[model samples]
Target: MEALLKEAPKVNHHLDHMPNMLVCENLQKVYPTPTGDYVVLDDLQLEIKQSEFVSIIGHSGCGKSTLLTMIAGLNEISGGTIYVDGEPVREAGPDRAVVFQSPSLLPWLTALQNVLIGVKQVFPSASKAEKLEICKYYLDKVGLGNDFHKKATELSQGMQQRVGIARAFALKPKILLLDEPFGMLDSLTRGELQDVLLEIWQKEKITAVAITHDVDESIFLADRVIMMTSGPYAKIGDELVIPFARPRNRKEVLEHPEYYDYRAYLLNFLNH
Candidate 1:
């Protein structure tokens, strides 16, 4: 553990020159209770470099989702500031798109239409055909090529999520926030979409932050895994840099020499 901590700085050395896409400084979340204020996150500081993919993990109710929503500007921040591209995050904007566990697609909308909801907002000036092209391209990328015209109500849960992911990417957001986007999916489907996300992320090069309970999914998708301590007042517990190279193969990652050691460290942190 000591050696790993010492070596952590080397992992992001490649990203050193890039500017920070998201910066959370002295961040906090609190709710005013009748009796007293309830605090969730406190003094949580994080710096995500441009185009970086980071996964955050912790036990339930540890402010994992809270933190994500705060960054999304969907939740109020009690203290500190969050910035994207050095601009303070004040409210939800086109620059950041979120994929929740539930796709929450309107039943009347087709898969393509569901995605166009955000696409139109982000690229209103583009021609109708150009918007359709962008939407269809992402849907196909997520393996929803044939279901473009299908209603959100008609698609399976997994398929609905594909639409959600397609929607997020189609908007061309500079930052993507994923709140357990695959939580409702079965293991097999979840694994497939994880790969799909990686593929899209690779091509788009958007900065992303994902909150997941699955540790393997964390290691497989993230360049670095940030673990949080249990909350009433949660903060960054520790972070581990994934040693595997990008465009990773699942099998290769699972078989890497350091896989189990890294896995053990994450598991140990969660356990304690």
Candidate 2:
């Protein structure tokens, strides 16, 4: 862990020079309702550099997940553009992969098969052996090596999400979009998964955006925590640059003075 923590500075320094992996400019989204058009997000601008971990937090209806869906191209934009690696994102593709709040796994498929479904979709040209290898590698990386043959119904909620994480990583995407992926778990399980995710992000250096309401989770996982105002036309309210060094220990993070300050500031922002 010490060595990993020491390496973070170098990784961050390298990220400073890399191009933006994801960019949203004047973004907007709206839905046509029975009476009128509902504006969910408007004039929202965000830029995420390569290898950065950023989390967005807000009230339930504040469009946090809506923004993520736009970036993933799962939702349409009423205005502006979203670019991934210099290309405009108009549809869902392998470049951006999303892990939703629910595990959303196929109950009948074994964990290994579930991940392979994505691997095959993204890398259809790979041989069967290669696909299997890719699936197993990520499953093992997420501490699920022994559960590969287990069906989704047989796994715990946490274990199922590990499969979801493995499936997303197996795609080797340019941007990872997570929408409250850990929100359903107990505190202990959520913390465990957070550590697993951090370890993978550190090694892979994939640009990541997560939507989470947990203040501690935001502080621990993100390079920057972006807070949003309440909807119906929500934009970025403020962004806090997390200063804690990585491989951040939960106990150490809680002990740091700025952690509490950050927590209090976020809580106040949300409650205001």
Candidate 3:
């Protein structure tokens, strides 16, 4: 067990020379109400390496999603700064793609068309043939090859979310931000998508940060789990390195003893 635990830190050692793919320093978020300013997050610092999958988990009001939005450059930061691939992020760009909790698909467009819209926007310089190939590839990658002609209104909720995933990956962003993208799926569907996502993360090695409420999901998906304290002025309280090797199987992960230990620790942290 101790040997298994040593593997994650070893991975970090080789990445010391690589510049961080994402960095958040002394991050702060505040919202103004009629009465006074409400502090949601303060003095938070986080760094994610190239291709690392990290999950942030905390209580409902801990500003987890808010932090993701700031990194995406969709929301203004009250203080501190965010850097992606060594460049400071000031606005949304093609370099980053985000998938939110609700599958925000254009209801009128077919799955292929929906993905093409994003691909064309992000890769406008590419030839039309190239863009069409990209759209087809990601939609197939998400197991939606047969449903390419279906619109959002004709698809199940799970299938709609798959379209969302395909659209995000079609952009070929260097970083992917997920704000509880699987929160609404059933357990079986969630597990299927988790494996699909992990396969893509392994193949592409894109830096990913996800905000999740499920402890088991974090253990299954992340290289490290960052836990936040209860709000107001919530910050990273603790973190656990998930030492399980990649190409991870759900059954194998469940059989591992340390998985339960990590689960217990996270449950305790959130409960207290």
Question: Considering every candidate listed, which one attains the maximal TM-score?
Answer: 1
lDDT digits (tens) for residues 1-272 of candidate 1: 66655655535776778899999999999989999999999999999999889999999999999999999999998999999999998998878999999988888999999998888898889999999899989999999968899999999999999889998898898999999999999999999999999988989889999999999999999988999999999999989888688898899999998788788889999999
Error of 1 at 126 (Å): 0.7
Q: In lDDT terms, how accurate is model 3?
A: 0.88
lDDT of 3 by residue, 50-76 (tens): 978899999898899999999998999
Error of 1 at 74 (Å): 0.6
Clashes of each: 0, 0, 0
Residue-by-residue lDDT tens digits, candidate 2, 1-272: 23333433323453578788889999999999999999999899998898889999999999999999989999888999999999999899878888989999999999999999999999989999999999999999999968899999999999999999999999999999899999999999999999999888878989999999988899899888899999999999977777688777778988986566778777878898
Q: Candidate 1 — what's its lDDT?
A: 0.91
Which model, 1 or 3, shows the larger TM-score?
1
| Regions more than 4 Å wrong, model 2 | 1-14
Candidate 2 lands at a TM-score of 0.93
Write down the lDDT of every candidate, Cα atoms only. Answer: 0.91, 0.89, 0.88
- Candidate 2 clash pair list: none
Task: Indicate whether candidate 2 or candidate 3 has the larger TM-score.
Answer: 3
Which stretches of candidate 3 lie above 4 Å from their native place?
1-11
